[model samples]
Target: MKRVQDWLLRFRWQKLLLVWGVFLLIAAVLFAERSGVQYTHTRFRLSYLPQEQAISKAQALQEQPATCLLLCDTRQSGVDNARELFTQLLQDMKVAADVVDLAEVSVNDLPAPENYQTAVVLMPNVEPLGEELLRLMNWVEDGGGLLFGMSPSNDRYFTVVSAKLGVLSTSGEYKQAESIVPAEGFMLGGGQRYELSDPFDSSLAVALREDTEVYAATGDEKVPLIWGRRQGRGRIVVDNIGIYDKVMRGFYAASYSLLQDAVAYPVINSAVFYLDDFPSPVPGGDGTYIRRDYGLSISDFYSQVWWPDLTQLAERYGIHYTGVMIENYEDDTLSAPERQTDTEQFRYFGGLLLRQGGEIGYHGYNHQPLCLPDTDYGDAYAYNQWPNADAITAAMDELIAFQKAVLPYAVGSVYVPPSNILSAAGREILGTRVPGIRTIASTYFEDGSGLPYVQEFDVAPDGIVEQPRIVSGGMVGDSYMRLAAVSELNMHYVSTHFMHPDDLLDEDRGAAEGWEVYKGGLVDYLNWLEKAAPHLRKQTGTECSGAVERFAALTVTTTGTNDAWELTLGNFHDEAWLLFRANDGVPGTVTGGQLTLLTGNLYLLKAEQPTVQILRQEG
Candidate 1:
């Protein structure tokens, strides 16, 4: 019995030691987590804007249906704070928002399609479901908006989401002082003091004070916290502060205000949905050529009746012309002799055009829409035939070969669809399949694609001048004159073409008594433009093409919503100064080299070679 007792005592002692080791291991893990965590101190209150007033103002706005999706892991304390804050925000803005717990719903069980127009996702400590979150980002890209908040513990997920949304989040921890006092220049509510003890820093705290500011600070090093970006038709507000701290919870007033503002801003601003690329000179001077349809089919009057007179008039007015060659088929049947004769005439005309400092771009193989399936061409002779991919390829090959044969004098060879009627497949063939063809005329799709907002501009039937297509041509007149002369203007670096010289010549004659009057008017307009808008620079189709290619190659550094932006124009040249307006204000100069801008409205910038660096400004 004594031996049994001794063995039992030894087992108890061993069990006690094991428990102590387990306790130490847990303690170590907790200590590591605490040490690595970031903390934010909320000691500063906005000097010019009080939290209550901001919230009150936001609440007074007409309410809209919006949801704040809180995706928190119930097991983490960080998520608990997020839940509490979300609950309070909903309670405060009951009319404007609803807080939805994503954890409660299955992936397939998202709210009905139209129940909400916006969402704020709180991903505090949970491991981000990468692919799933990526899919959700698609909603914002499609016009639905989102707001994201995360902690340093989830840096991997934060980075993935940031990249997809065109933003970047830092890796280290940041801290706000234990308390803060407003500075003299503070724009928000008058001098006020506050206390803070949150684990994560509120890097975006300054943004909450006004509609027009962005504030950020890096980790403990205090590398001026910079963390805010506009993302795909929506705004994303990021704070490095820990989600679980009481100090952060105390700022619920400001946080809720921000949430309310994000939801309401889009509705109140009509211009948010209307964005466009500022018109600037095409990067290179090569985009100035013209596109024309019809080679030899036009009656000999083209040269004998129109060329001599038009050439003389253009020379007198210091204007040049570039003729685009098109195969005009009055009837499908043409004897070999007639075909050869017509081809020769085209070559002769092309030579004349080049000698006169003009260019000749392709106007489709036979002045037809190049679509797949010959059956789709129907009975219209103008439709020609693009039976299949092979047929289209063959046609383009023949046309290019013919043009090359006429070489040396062809001078700047490019192709322009007869009536802007090429299919996607045709575009692919021109852009990729065809080799040695340096450039393709800008198409409608190129101009309108991916614009943040809907806008109306002039569009010509042929891919020529980018003009506003007002219904009444007589209202603006046939010259395509602009209505208002603002300091800034958007000029598309595109080649413009007009039909047979006879049409333009006739219009000129009808508008004036003779060629001299026409010449005088043209010269006067050019002179006035140069004097009034000396920055206007001419670009050729090739230059425009190169610029576009370069633009395509650039990597987008950031993205976000909010119409206001601050862009950096680095190392620009004297000749490349661009004109722009801030926040829809009057036009201002955008000198090249290093420049900064802040504005809400869209403006035009003119430059020969310009690089754009964008930052979102809250106001």
Candidate 2:
């Protein structure tokens, strides 16, 4: 028995050592496989659309008999602003609404109400119209659509038409609406409050009738922001919210949609997602969040935990991320930067991104903004400016060279500025020096500090397309979601969202909430966005630029009768997308296009030809 025990003890250590070595080998194999140890060189290219030499601007209000008339009084401040707002809105919607300047005509020259199916009155007062206003009211009762395009004046003139506008009573004074609360199912991302920035007295304090449907209102008191009511056989929509800015454009567009039986317009129909500062350098963020939640360092947390979550999200939603590479986080502005030699991390992350049907974009060689020394970053961001144009160009060239050396892919066509900051000199460099870059993605709206670069979705004079990021961060706030929803309606359904790898490290971006909570907020936002716009085609940065190109080049001329509407598209490319709304009729047939039902009364149409015909049955 003593000999047996002695033999067992000696072999036990050997067996245990053998078991530990086998486990280590298995773990190493898994780590290699999961981390993409074997990098695959991928050739990436921008999917630019066929360009047209010259695209004509769509002429607003053709000589053909108009279907809608807009009464604009250039004398009144509200009317002037409303005209500017509605003119662009109608032009985008392809609605043949003729503008009739009240200053150019007398009360006797007012057109008969029977001449148009719908009318928008932008005048603060109707005293100049005299008895002619009664003719329009009678026309509304006899099956015409009317929209009070601006907040009505508090006078006897508006009081007389108040009944037709669904106003049961009014305090006759303007009220300050603190927040915009859209009703459930009223807009894309409804059932939420979008707080106003320093709200003013822009809406009237009016009580609506019981039967009047309120689409939007003030958050606290529920004062009608936008409401609609039926008078006899006609419908009337009142846009009580008087604020007019770029942000309010979509809200007003939606309110105008309620004035018609049907409305159809072209949309970009693309959604792009961007990852800033990805696959470049490991961000130095506070490790408390990672340590507390995952017991891992920030660097290890990104590889093992954060990246896995993002990749899983992409897989679940079939999202293709455009990762903008930042070669290093060093602020090396004066010197000509050398090509980065440590290519393992870049290869690993870039390879993983490409394998998932993603694309790489140019951010910067370093974390510095591309502004000249004269430019100031202000208090919001502390970024060093470039010494001169030569320095900026040298850094950019080094960035391009490093990207080329690491990956077999062509230089990316999209360039996103660091911290969304770029100066006139920097832009000139990109336009002239960086010939491969075709698009610049920056912030859409200003953050008021004048630090972030602000842009509109349009082709710049230098021929570079501007595809601005509309929303950002994992903790998508109410205001950001509101902007997303509004842009979807006005910008023809294009959404640009950007995020960063180091968002987990910053407390301002909800890092202290831990990965689960931080990631949950992003997931919830994605879920809401998916539910709101399932039809939005997921595109990468270059693909989105391609979509913007097509949308910009095409001009739509709408002509229709009572039962049919024909759209003739100019500069028609290989394909075109449009949003057609059937408000008063059922779509009977669509020719020269394929129709996909998106939601109630909305159909996404893919036009194959320049001329698309739509036939509808009377509702």
Candidate 3:
């Protein structure tokens, strides 16, 4: 006390002012809290920030209605990384949202419940309490749709939301299962048993309360896995499907279907097809179908068998298949047959396809990535072949030169890596090499396995893009899986499907089988494609690259709804129309990237950066 008095007395005015400032800060905080001001902080960006045109058309579309709020309370426990991933998944799901961290908003400044039709709470560790709880209750009661995920802390929310919304109540216990089969439904699972990551917390069998609407259920016919009910003016959907294991097992499409179908979200134009293992047939296979030697050289097979079938399919379906070009299938000693016919027959075939609205994409040199002949990330794994950077670069250059040789000016910037495997180093070779490649053709989901590379599509620090192919011509009978894959792909505004004419031949799925044997699977899938997602526009690999390049250059902002959506794309690509997944409804007119829906989510000729608007007819 004496020291304080002495100090205050010596620097009396300055010390007094400092003390007053501190006192005022504390007092103001206390007063604001007591006075019921809604305290708000912006939710940190959670999704991968896509590179878009600096001048976005979204500026005009800003005030457009929102479909959902990606809810993440920054103050919550265990929300740092998981929340960001969840946000990314939502963005990947193509759901437009305002990432709202309610903790940051003052109650007075909160937007009306009507502003957003749906409120999504995914894997939030902290249950909304106190004033936040009250605000949530008000929003739901006043007609806001609620979509929530399962977590330990979900009980508090479930109890409150269930009671108010008149939905089912649960103790928040996960029904244990090692493998559970889903009935034929669009939401989750298949008739075949699904492998669970956590056997103990596989799925939840929620007991439905009165007035609950059940759309899907488990095999037992007793427990409800998915159910929903109307609450006041809002709707509540309960998705008790657990994704922990599915995500681990790489069944990304199933997980998406469950979450999205639970709400019956509008799905349009979201698929791309790339037919791999074509033109270049690799030798020495698994003995099921990969023969010891040639039935015919790739050029003859493509010219005689695949081309006509593909061209017919394209004519019938209004689609162009992307046939990957492999310059060399074997060693120079073994490639004599390939060389003899390649220049004459192969280029002619390639040129014919290009003229027929087909696309040509690079596979690899001698069916190998830029790597030493023996460096093995795995058999057919091109991404991790080389032990060092120099080896990888050398191999990359060889491949680039090979493409230049094969197609000359016709070579596409899209590189469908051998076996859909790529390492960060291999990607670097694409970005850093002179006359480097632009887009990558592989699944968006990649696992780097704790290496220097990131398991993803987009190469970091450089602008190498990845256009992921979501569907392949496998499991020709699994219509629902195809549906899930296409819808999910559409969510990202990119559709990719790959098939090999070989697969149509052998007992194997992706083998280079003859056209006569392969046509059945193709026919079934194409018919299903027409029936299921006919609205999605199909583009050749070249067009897909053009669209990606165009989209990358454009500023994109989206206004979305359950039935319709509008993407205002700025800085459009010249002669580059972006194909969008939209419904077979009113495709609003536009200048750039004009909209068209084939049936469910297919279309063609989306001019680059088209400000397309989709209008859903109110049923």
Give one digit per residue, the lDDT tens place, for model 2 in 96-185.
677888899876887877888889888777777778788888888898888888888887878888888888999888989788887766
Task: List model 1 lDDT by residue over 1-619, tens digit each.
Answer: 9998788677857788778999999998665333322212211111111112222212332243344454444554466676665554443233245544545655455554235555656665334444556656666556554545544343566556645433434434445543332221211211223333332354422212223233323323333222334456444444444433322322332222232222111000000000011000111111111112222223443445445665674565333443445444322222221222235445555555444444455654555556654334333334544656766666666656555555343534345554445566676666566654544442322222231111112111222222111111111122223211110121221112233332223343332233234435444544443343333333333333333222212211112234423333222222123223232123233232223221123223433344443333433
User: Which of the two candidates, 1 or 3, achieves a greater TM-score against the reference?
Assistant: 3
How well does model 3 score by local distance difference test? 0.50
State the weakest 10-residue window (summed lDDT) of model 3.
Answer: 39-48
Candidate 1 — which residues are off by over 4 angstroms? 1-300, 312-320, 327-344, 374-382, 409-413, 442-497, 502-534, 550-578, 582-619
For model 2, the local distance difference test gives: 0.77
RMSD of 3: 26.7
The 0-to-1 C-alpha lDDT of every candidate, in the order given, reads 0.37, 0.77, 0.50
> Which of candidates 1 and 3 reaches a greater lDDT?
3
**Top-scoring candidate (TM-score):** 2
True-vs-predicted CA distance for residue 398, candidate 2, Å: 1.9
Model 3 over residues 40-116: C-alpha lDDT tens digits? 22111111223443222223234444566766566755444445555545443334567766577654555555576
Worst 10 residues of 1 by lDDT: 266-275
